[model samples]
Every structure is written in structure tokens, then in C-alpha cells.
Target: MHITMHDIYKSFGTNRVLTGVNFDLQEGEIHALMGENGAGKSTLMNILIGLHQRDQGTIMIDDKETYFESPKEAEQRGIAFIHQELNVWSDMTVLDNLFIGKERTSNFGLLNMKEMKALATEQFRKLSVSIPLNQEAGKCSVGEKQMIEIAKALMTDAKVIVMDEPTAALTEREIRKLFEVIASLKKDGVSIVYISHRMEEIFEICDRITVMRDGKTVDTKAIPETNFDDVVKKMVGREITDRYPERTSNLGEIVLEVKNTSKKGQFKDVSFSLRAGEILGFSGLMGSGRTEIMRTVFGIDSLDKGEIWVHGKKVSIRNPEDAVKAGIGFVTEDRKDEGLVLDFSIRDNMVLTNLHSFAPKGLIKDKKEQEFVDVLIKRLQIKTQSSATLVRSLSGGNQQKVVIAKWIGIGLSVLILDEPTRGVDVGAKREIYQLMNELTERGVAIIMVSSELPEVLGMSDRILVVHEGHISGELSKQEATQENIMTLATGGQ
Candidate 1:
């Protein structure tokens, strides 16, 4: 075995995050560590990388016991971690970000800029990424940034690399490219610990699968010996009879319409219509303008020139308040930065958007507020100790549920979700799917923007692919395939 973790336990205060978790990684093999959000996948990975100390555990690397006091120690021992969130600097160039911490000094004590750039260039070549070395990393697309992150880890001469949702932000084409890179890495005998909610990718790439649930390891099986359904059943502890809720042909008249929506440098000629009881999916490459289209529609960013119609009447949306007033709900891609108020409790955040409805005689109704929050908590299956628990104290999936519940409480005719299940676990993702079906059943229109091809394919009745600020293609549920979507997304004519 390349790495072995036994009897791992970690806790935050009185709450246990990881419980007696055990896992092993073998050389020249791809091992998938599967779990839902708050299931201790991140905690266990952090322990391996030394971000958090385990309460009890024994870590063995290459058949020898090892203790990592810091991430640098883990790095020196040929271990590298690629986080879900990119850790590169936005202000620095790609070459600089890769070589910033450890610079090779010449005999005269000068930084070796030429050698560093050459090495960074070589690494990018190996990954089939063509990012400019001198360009600021922030200007690159999310997929480019991801490739850069992985390249940095590889540059460390890592024997084992733990990737957390590496393809969450990538498009179908980029995902295929990533799989190729992973295959090459496996051929070179690099052990990979892959964590993802995507079971299809797990079956496609991983050699062995380890299932984690409620902070404990349930089973580890070879990929060929197990299937996606079996792995999901193990991760969720129940069989999912339906991947998506039943859709009825009960769509009402057009609720929201965009006429030739153009955001100049962001998106162009984006025309789409949403009606009650329909889920429309927007999909494309990282910079394909899916999120940008949502932002423009939500009035977070001004449209260069376009006409918006709500309920068959032309309306000018100058700000988010206008969009909200028009009965449009938007859950942004960056939830932490744009969606949640981390310091507030669930009740406070729940009523933030619709406080006027619950306030009586200009007085906030605490009891009524609690009632509303409680209803949402239960409706969305949001796991929490209490409705009064601070939003930040919850896991990523629970936090997302809170965000969705907040909007569902306010009442919306058109809902826009950008990467709604990006970091969410399988169980929570299924719950969200069920909630979407329930909402559609009640005649609510949904516009979902996602980077996961399988998710978009599985959940959407219609899919729109964007490429370089324009709509490249639109595919129906029957026509949508990984091959066709990737063809259009990567500039195929």
C-alpha cells in the first residue's frame, strides 16, 4: 500500500467530524473516497495533509508510521493536496504562482526566473493546458485555474495526490481532458485519492472505491466489482428509486423571458424563456457565460442591451431588488461570497429576503420567523442541531440547503441556480433534486446552471451549451450526450 490510515477520529468541540475511519491507497492505482457533505471526507483528507490533527489514528506512508505536523511536512514526504477551492493567487501570474513559495537560487543568490518559467511551461504541456505563463491567474477560466492547481501539485514530485472535486468546475471537454491526465499519472505509478460526488466519473476513472457515510467507512470495493447504483446505495444508506422526480406537463404560460440578452464582453444574444413547471439547464465551459447570464438576469450586473419580460410585460431590472420584486430567485455560484450571511443564524438568514412579510406592524415577529425557518429546515431536510444554529457551523451541503430554503420560503416564480450541487454530497444532492421536482410540481420555473455534464444531462429537460460568450448549441434531453456537448463546447463548428 502507498498510504494507510487506521482508526481515524477527529472532532470539533463536542461534535465528532470523523469517526474511526480507515482507508488505504495503493501505488499506481486510483482510489475514490466517496461520501456526502459533512461525512468526514474533508476532515480525513485534512488529517492526511496535516490541516487538522486527528484525535486518534495511525498514519502509515510506504509501510512506515508517519506523523505530519504541518502540510509542508506532508509535502516533503511526497504527499500533495489539491483543495476544492483554488489556492493560487489571483494577482500573480501563473508562472509566479507556481514558483513563488520555493524559488531556486543561483550561486549568486538570484532567483532562477528562466528555469522556473520553463518548468511551469513543461508542466502545463503535460496536462494539455495552454494558459499563458505571464498572464494573471485570476483572468483565466475556472478550468484553467484547476489545471494550474493540479500542475503545481505534480511539480512537487508527489507520490500520492489527494484531489477534492477536481472536476466540479470543469466542462465536459475539460473533464475528458482531466481523465486523460489522470490515466497518464496512473501509468507513471502515482497513487491518487479522488473525492467526488460524481459516481459516473468514479466508475470511469477510479480503480478502487471506498464508501464513507456519517463519518465512518462502510465498504471498499473494486470498481469493476461494483456499479454506480451500488456505490450510491452504500454512500446514502438507501436505494434511490428515481434519480429525478417525475415531471408532469403542467407548465403554465411564460413567466420570465429574455430577448436577445447581451452583456457585451460576457455574453451575447442570449435568448431564453422560462415557464412554470420547467427546469432549464445552462451548461458550457468554465468561461462560457452560464454564470454571467444568471448574474445579468438577476440584475447583479447590468446588461449591455436587452429586453426582459416578466409575465408578458417589459420591465427594466436595474438591481437585485428589481429582480426579486419581479419574483425572480437567484442562487449565485459563489455561495460563501454571495449567498450566505455566515455570522447569522438560520432563522435570521431565512427571513432576510422576505422580512416584510413576517414583520407585524413594523415589528419583526420572532415566533413567526422561527415557524417559517423550522418549516424550511424540515422541508429541505437540512441537517442541523437547531434552527438557531449559526449558518457557518453547518457543513457545505447543509449551508447550501439553507440558501435554497431561504429562497423557497420567500416565494419565487422563476428560480436560477448556478452550480447548485458543486460541493454538495450525493445524499443532499438527491434531496435537492427531489425538492426541485416538488417545486416544479407546484408550478415554479427553474433555470439551473451547472458545470457537471452528468448532472445537467440527468436533471434537465433541455440543455444549452455556451462557448466563448455565445450559445454554441442547445440539446434536448434525448439529444444530449457527452460527445455532442463536448464537440460544441470546445469550438467545433
Candidate 2:
């Protein structure tokens, strides 16, 4: 199958998202869509998949003009999409989520659990995934959920698959497995539309690349013809000399400390100390209890046994509110599920954490709130028409920024960041790193949980490697390297 979109234009109210964009996909090849968040890559795809109508565009498939009325129509035409955000049904079992709308049924029209489980098991095996078919989808880790999404898409018998940030949550081992699966699919004459901000992976897997900027298509080139610098220049329209901003923060006394923390079936005997003006980097594979440990610290999940101390005083945090009162803020890994209310406006989401500070005596000072929101929006470079804009409409990168802004307004003593730059582009990523540097300069301690080795090595003053719920090893910034971190993360000596 071959697909082409030309002269695409889209707008929401007064916000112009995409204008005069051109993209094309060829059979038996991998085409990459590279851009910063809100650059209209997603909008163009959404228009193609019939989720949204294009105000102006021409879509052609196999030399004939074609437009899908719904995603079901596109799926029936052999096109599948694995979105950046995982779409797993939390309450449903893994098998159910795998065949959600199109379940297998017997001759009598009764449900066929055995057939569904067998198909799901085969897909998981192909992806080298080990998740149980009977487990609740929500119980799976982010990486596991990511793999499930990929497997579900593969089960569609799609000739063309559009994958957006598919490996953002995957571990090195799983990433390798996914790459192998992609290779096999390509060999089977499937065309792939790969979207990711990871430059390395794009160059490694894609055959051609298309970059968008400010609602326009900058250029398209073969992967062999374009270098990483060229693609980034087109994506952000600027030369990024440093991938990561230099870190300079003097360490102070420990601000938050956890001792002998244990969460049943998650982590065990975990202990760590976070000091003011220092970035404590948590390095580990996904599902290695890194996120669970932070959830326990933030009181989202209970610690079966542990002691938490803030500012050298013990605090009993029974819930997230209690954790907030104790001066700890958490930027959760799953932003859509835990960080922001999709239905709420950007302003409303920003003030969720600092409501007490803004609303004295149950009265909100609208002027002060607006000013605060405006300042952070400018500081963070969040692309939004107005604070009244709903958060659900913002791009993934901007949504993550809102989550960070909400926690930043709380004036917490300790901040826990999980996968802070998972879907962020190069320019915005530098901006975030600069913000972290400034925050540390202001004496706020941060515990960053990241799967990106370069981020851990670049921004952290100290690093702790986690393997299967244990603190396998700790290393200073000067001593840590990718090899050492991987060795420790994989439970090697």
C-alpha cells in the first residue's frame, strides 16, 4: 500500500495547527515523521485516520484519492496506528484489551476466550513480551503497556503501521526485540510510519525522514542523505550545540530520606537520600520498581514497611495530600492517568497543586492566578493559545510541561520526576534541563527517574542503579557510564 497527503491544513478555533503540509508513505519501507511537539505531525496523521477532518488536503492511496470516514474504515483498509499514549483499558484483562472491539466468537456467537488467549499469546511471543494474558491491563508497567500496544497493532494484519514514540518506555532488551520484529514486518512487505524524537533510533530504523516545523513541512530526505544535525535543524529550526545543559548546583544537607522502604510485590528494602541542590538520578530498566518506589514515596501506593523523613523530621504520609503537606511533589510517569485532568483548562490544571497558596480563605485571586500561569507558560515555552485552553488539546510535550509546572508551583522541598523527557523534543528538552538547573540553584532537591542513559549521565550529580526492586549499585557522576549502569541494571556484578 502507498499513501500520500498533500497540502494539508488544519485549525482549531483561532489556533492554526497545520498549514500546507505534505507527507507520503511507500510500501515495504520505513518512513519517519520527525518534529517538535505540536508541529502538526499528529494532526496530519489524525486527519488521515479519519479522527479529524482536514480543512484542506488531498489524500491518495495507490494512485487513487481516498479518505477514511473512521478509524475502523482505515483499519479495514490495512492501516494501523500505535499512538504515543498507551490506550490500554485499565479494568479489562490483557486478552480483552488485545481484541477489544473485534473479539473472536464461536459458531453460536458466544465469546471464545481460548481463541483470544491463543492469538494474544502468539502476538506476545512474537514481540518477546512476557505479560500474562489474565492480568489486568492497568497492573502492567509502562513498557509492558507499550509492548501490548505494538502487539495489538501487529494483530490487525496491517500493511502500513504508524507508530508514535513506540519505544519511549521500553528497556534496552525490549527495544532490541521490537527492532527485530519491525525488521521482520518490513521484510514481509509492510510499510511503517515511525514517529519519534530519538534521533539514534530514527537513523537506525527508518529509510526516509520528513521533518515539520511551525505547522509546515520543512523537508524530506533519505536517511542516508540526511544527518542528525540536518534533521534537528529542520525540526526545531535552530542549531542545538549541547544536547544537555551543563549542570552546576552545590549540594546541601539531605532534604528527604527513605530508609528500609518495602512495597509488597514491587520493591524491597529500598533506601535513598536526596539532598538540596542535587539531582539524584535513578537509573534502571522499565518495571524494575523505579516508578513503584517513587509512588510509594509520594504516598500514591503504600509502603509495607519503611520510614520517610523530610527536613530531618519523620512524616507520616498516608495519601498524596499528606505527601504534598509534607513538601513532596511527584510528576507521575503516566501523565494522562495521574498528572492532569484532560477535561480541565491549562490554568485549572496548573493551579491544582498550588490552590491553597492562591485561594486564601476559599477565594481565588484571578489576576494573580493568570499572572502566574502566564509567567510559567512563557518560561517553559508551552505552546498554547490561552490558559483557558483544555489540556487534552495540547501536544504530548506541552502536556508534560503543564504537569511539571503544576508541581513546580507547589514550592515543595523535594520533587520526584519520572521519565521527565520521555516524549519531549531536543529544544524543549534543553529548556527543561535548564529549568532543573535553576530549581536546584534555588535549593530544591530532585529525584529524577529516567530510562535514557544520556540524561542520567548528563544531569545527575549522583546515580543509583535499580535491578529487580533492589538498589544494585550507586555511582557518582564522574564514575558512571552507560556500560556500568547497564551492567548494574541487568543484575550483573
Candidate 3:
């Protein structure tokens, strides 16, 4: 075995997150760790990478017992981790990001510029990525940034690598390139602990799969021996018979219309009409103006020139507050940055949108607020001990639920969801999709922006492919395919 974690136990304060977790990975194998949201997948990965120490456990690496005191120590011991949150300096160059902490120094403690640059260039070439060593990292696309994060792991000469949702922001082509890199690394005898929400990816690349549920190991099986349903059942402790609920609402008149919408350098000439009970999907690469258009529509970004019609009436939305007042709700792409207040309690985050409505003379009505939050928590099935728990303590999947629930409380007519299921697990994603269907059934119009092609195609009634700050093509549900979307999104229209 390349790595073995036995009887792992971890907790935060009085809450036990991971309990008696056991996992093993063989050399040259991609071991998959599957679990529901807040099932302790990330906690286990953090423990392995030395971000969080296990309360009790035995880790055997390379036939010897090992304990990592810090992330640096883990890297020194040939273990590297790429967290879901891309950790890279935006101001630094790609080369600098890869060799930031592991730079080669002389015996006198002097920096070795020539050797470092040479090594960085060699690694970039080997990875088949053409990145300027001196260019700022912020100028790169999300895929490029993700590639830089992956390359950074290689700098440590990592014998074992743990990637948590690495492909969340990557395009299909970029994901393919990453798979190729993983294959090369496997041939070089590196064991990979791959954690992803995509079932296709797990079956495609991983050799063995370990499923966890409620902080316990449910099963460990070979990839070919099990299917998606089996894995999902193991993770959620329930069978998901239906992934997306049926859409059974009659189409209504256009509720939101954006005509000739342009934000100058950001997005241009984006025109679309959304009707009641319609879920319009915006598909594109990371920098292809999908999120920019959503931000512009939500009034988070200034629109240089455009006209927005709400129910056939012209509306001027200068800010997010104005957008909210106009019966529009926006769920941003970066959940950690814009979605929820990590330090705030679930009840606080839930009622934040309508806090003023629940307040009298600037004093919050605790009874009224609690009533609504309690209903929402149960309705959404948010996995939390209490509504008073911090939003940060909840898993990524549950945090996304809180985001959706927040917008749902607004009684929105036009909902714009950007990467709604970006970090959400399968079961939670299904719940979200069902929730979208329920909203539309009640005549709510939705505009969804997603990088995952299957989701865009599966959930949207119509998909608009954006490329270079403009819409390249638009397709109905029957006409949309991954190939067609990618071709148009890459300017091959």
C-alpha cells in the first residue's frame, strides 16, 4: 500500500466530524473518496495533508508509520494536497506560485533564481502548459489557475496527492489534460486520493473507490464492480430514484428581458428573454462572460448600455438592492466570497435577505425570524444540529443549500443562479434541481450559469453559449449537446 489511514478520529470542539474512518491507497492507483456534503471527506483529506491533525489515528506511508505536523511537513514527507479553494497568490506569476514555498536555495541561504526558473520552465513544458513565467497569475483563466495549483503539487515531488474537487472550474478539455497528467504521475508511481462530485470522473480515472457516510466508511469497492446509484446510496444512505423532478408548469409571458446588454470591456450585446417557468442556461468557459453577464443583470456590475424589461415594463437597476426590489435574486458564483456569511449562524444567514421586514424600529423580531428559518431548514433538509450553528461549520453542500434557501425566501420572480451546483455533491445537487423545478412550477423564472455541460443540458430549457463576451449560439433542450456547446463556446461558431 502507498498510504493507509486506520481508525481515524477527528472533531471540532464537541462535534465529532470524522469517526473511525479507514482508507487505503495502493501505489500507481487513483483512490476515490466519495461522500455526501458534510460527510467528512474534506476533513479526512485535511488530516492527510496536515491542515488538521486527527484526534486519534495511525497513518502508514511507504511501509512506515508517519505523522505530519504541518502542511510543510506533509509536503516534505512527499504528500501534497490541492484544496477545492484554489490557494494561489493572484499577484504572483505562475512559475512563482508553483515554487513559492519549495524554492531551491544555496548553502548560504541565498535564492537560486537561475535554477528555479529553469526548473519551473521544465515542469511547465512537461505539463504541456504554455504560461509566461513573469505574467501575473490574476491575468490567467480559471483553468490556468487550476493547472498552476496542480503543478505546485509536483514541485514537492509528491509521492501521494489529494485533490478535492479539482475539476470544479475546469472545462472538459482542461479536465482531459489533467487526466493525462494524472496518468503520467501514476506511471511515475504517485498515489492519488481523488475526491470529486462527478460520478463519471470517478469511474473514468479511479481504480478503487471508498464511500463514506455520516463520518464513517460505508464501503470500499473496485470501480467496475459498482455503479453511480450504488455509490450515491452509500454516500447519502438513501437511494435517489429521481435526479431531476418533472417540469409540469405551463409557459407564461416573458418576465425578465435583457436587450442589447453591454458592459463595455466585460460583456457585450447579450440579449435574452426569460419567461415564467423557464430555466435558461448560460454555458461557456471560465472567462467567456457567463458570470459577467449574470453580474451585470443582477446589478452587481455596471451596465454601460442596455435595457431591462420586467413584465413588459422598463426597469433601472443600479445596484443589488435595486435588483432585489425589482423581484430579482442572484446567487453568485463564488459562494465563500459572496453567498453566505461564514461567521454568521444558519438562522442569521437564512433571514438576512429580509431582515428589515422582520424588524420593528431596527430591532429584530426573534420569534418571527425563528419561525421562518425553522420551516426553511426542515423544508430544505439542511444537515445541521441547530439553526444557531455557524454557516462555516456546515459542509460545502449544505452552505449551497443555505444560499438557495436565502433566495427562495425573497419570493423572486426572476432568479439568476451562477454555478448553482459547483461544489455540491450528487444528492444535494438533485435536491437543488428539484427545488428549481418546484420554483418554476410556481411560475418563477430562472437563469442558470454553469461550467458543467451535462448539468446545463439536463436542467435548462434553453442554453446560450457565450464566447469572447458575446453569445455565439443558442439552442433548445433537444438541440443542445456537449460537443455543440463546446464548439460554440470556443468561438468555433
RMSD of every prediction: 2.4, 1.0, 2.2
Per-residue lDDT of 345-429 in model 2, one digit per residue for the tens? Answer: 9999999989887889899999999999999999999999899999999999999999999987667889999999989888899
Per-candidate local distance difference test:
0.85, 0.92, 0.87
Candidate 2: residue 49 lDDT (0-100) = 88
- Residue 217 shift from truth in candidate 1, angstroms: 1.2
Q: Candidate 1 — what's its lDDT? A: 0.85
Expressed as tens digits, the lDDT of each residue in 228-254 for candidate 1 is 788889888898876665665477889
Top lDDT hit = 2
In order, how many clashes per candidate?
A: 0, 0, 0
- Candidate 1, superposed: residue stretches over 4 Å from native: 108-110, 139-141, 360-362, 388-390, 490-493
Tell me which residue pairs clash in candidate 1.
Answer: none
Give candidate 1's root-mean-square deviation (CA, Å).
2.4
What TM-score would each prediction reach against the true structure?
Answer: 0.92, 0.98, 0.94
Error of 3 at 86 (Å): 2.6
What is candidate 3's lDDT per residue for 1-493, written digit by digit as tens? 3888999999899889989999999998999999988889999988887889999989898789987889888888788899876787888877778788777898889988888889888877777778788889977755677778887887778888999888987777778878998998999999999999999999999999999988899999999999999998889888998777666656799999999999877788889899999999999877778888888788888899999999999999999999999999998867776799999999988888888778868998889889999998998889898999999888877898898888876678999998889778998898899889989989999999888988998889988999989999999888999999999999997
Error of 3 at 238 (Å): 2.0
Best by TM-score: 2
lDDT of 3 at 488: 98
**lDDT (C-alpha) at residue 441 in model 2:** 93
